[model samples]
Target: MQTQDSRARPLLIYLHGFLSSPQSFKCQLMREWLTANNPHIVFCAPQVLPYPAIAQQSLVGLLEGFLRSANCGPVGLLGSSMGGFWCTYLGERLHLPAVLINPAVRPSRFMPAYVGRVLRPYSGGTQEYRLTEADVDTMGRLEAELAQPLHSRYWLLSQRGDETLDYRDAENFYRSQRQTVEEGGDHGFQGFARYCAPIVEFLFNQQ
Candidate 1:
């Protein structure tokens, strides 16, 4: 295990939302906030592939590689929307804490209709992203696997008026863990910058 110090506060692995790249607004905001507020923390936002099986495996492998390569111990994960789903799975597997923002708790069920020709967001244009039946099946299995008891290793941040995802889904999934539900904010939390300090404090304050 690596010792924490000025050079390494803690590893903050950020997983961006679906159809969004690692360079999404939320990820950029996080990088900037950390640079200004907590420069010691190492932040990593990897670009995930569009294919579900390949993406999940690649992300998990990358995360493990990062941990081993950096000698990071007890890292924290922060994911938004579909990325939140990944954070949930990784957090469980690694036995680490996570902060999920407007997480997609039931993506397998929710994304069934939008399975073809996904429009990439934040790429400055649209691209034809394929979603095969195999992808859906793999996601279904992942969902079932994730349905096991949560380790109480998460903090869910959700908004009541999220149009992209139903807040109840997160409310139900994280019912056993600590949650902070704000009113009137959309899927992307309104005034998200304001929550950065609090989130960092919460994650780093723990031993």
Candidate 2:
């Protein structure tokens, strides 16, 4: 027989990509889906700091707070891009399952070009922030601490036509885990709606 805690609604945390916000397309899609089909499940997509150093602090605080508040239910993570990296770290540390979408295996190697001024594509904000070397170093440190795969605890989703970050890196990194590789999709993971069902199953239905 399932205990009350075991049957409690699962909390789903959606971590958006770098330079993105909770209002991102994928985040919004998940929100809408939960609101429509699974009203009992709580969905959260907190805005993370743009810089790696600040984001590390903020993200941890958010997760810690959630863990304390939701004491009786399971929690799952759904992360895209840079957020995927964070999900992997948090999942391993918290011993929770995570679903990564076109995750960045080594963002530190590519963060140099973005060290200066950058625009927020999702939010129509005129403000731009200068990324720094310290930020890059922080990312490097986090990347260095990557946990060995818990194949049963992860689900990696990649697309062959991703233009921003190469999919091969993630494929190679998560090959031992459950993965779904599709053809002719972009960095945004076009047709994301189609995968919504599987994503939900990966997060909540799997034992």
Candidate 3:
């Protein structure tokens, strides 16, 4: 990140995990915490579409547009689960730093099971999605887009007890990076709120 713009507030975009939304617990906690404690920081947690390709288009458009519309200051990225996959993609392309929480290392492997009509539980099951074989196959595009050493720009947080994802995958892949691997937390990254302040400090304050 460069010098603070002095024209607009710094921004932090939180990317929610698979089958999740901006309404997810962690996203809400981030929003509320910033509102109360760091109101100067701009926080955004867009509901990423389930489909891989479209989600990419929307997010890229959102971020690029935000930068074009305002002289914003430093930007931060935080992602969980599938969003972690995207946080890496976007962070790399934008040359920004990120903090990933139990992120999915190989979504294409498991996404095949989700290929077809899907119900998003986080959206009260109101959001109906169709996951295609093409979507499953395209997951690697984002993974392959990573151009830098994971340790150079990412801070990882994973737990051994994640039933949805194997924590070892992230631990091993992000090895040598600054990370925290807890003993018994689930895919939701147990006790996520405690790190909100520190996460902001890392993304906005650190190089």
Highest-lDDT candidate: 3
Candidate 1, residues 1-207: lDDT per residue as tens digits?
Answer: 544552444789899888788778889999999999888888889876656798789978987886786445458889999999999988887677889999998787766676775555656555657787778888888888776579747889999999999999899989998899998999878888878888887677874
- Count backbone clashes in candidate 1: 0
Steric clash pairs (candidate 2)? none
Q: Regarding lDDT, does 2 or 3 come out ahead?
A: 3
For candidate 3, the C-alpha RMSD (Å) to the true structure equals: 3.0
User: lDDT of all predictions, in order shown?
Assistant: 0.82, 0.84, 0.85
Task: Estimate TM-scores for all models.
Answer: 0.90, 0.91, 0.91
| lDDT tens digits by residue: candidate 2, 1-207 | 877555667789999997888889999998998899877788989887668878888878788887887453678899999889889888876777899999988999888887876656466666567788888998999887775655338888899999999999999888888999999999889888887778888888885
Q: Show where candidate 2 strays beyond 4 Å.
A: 1-8, 70-72, 150-152
lDDT of candidate 3 over 1-207, digit per residue (tens): 545545578899999998888889889999999999999999999989888888999999988888776576788899999989888888777778889999998888888888876556575866688788888778867667664465348899988999999988888777867888899989888899899999999998885
The CA lDDT at 188 in model 2 is 89
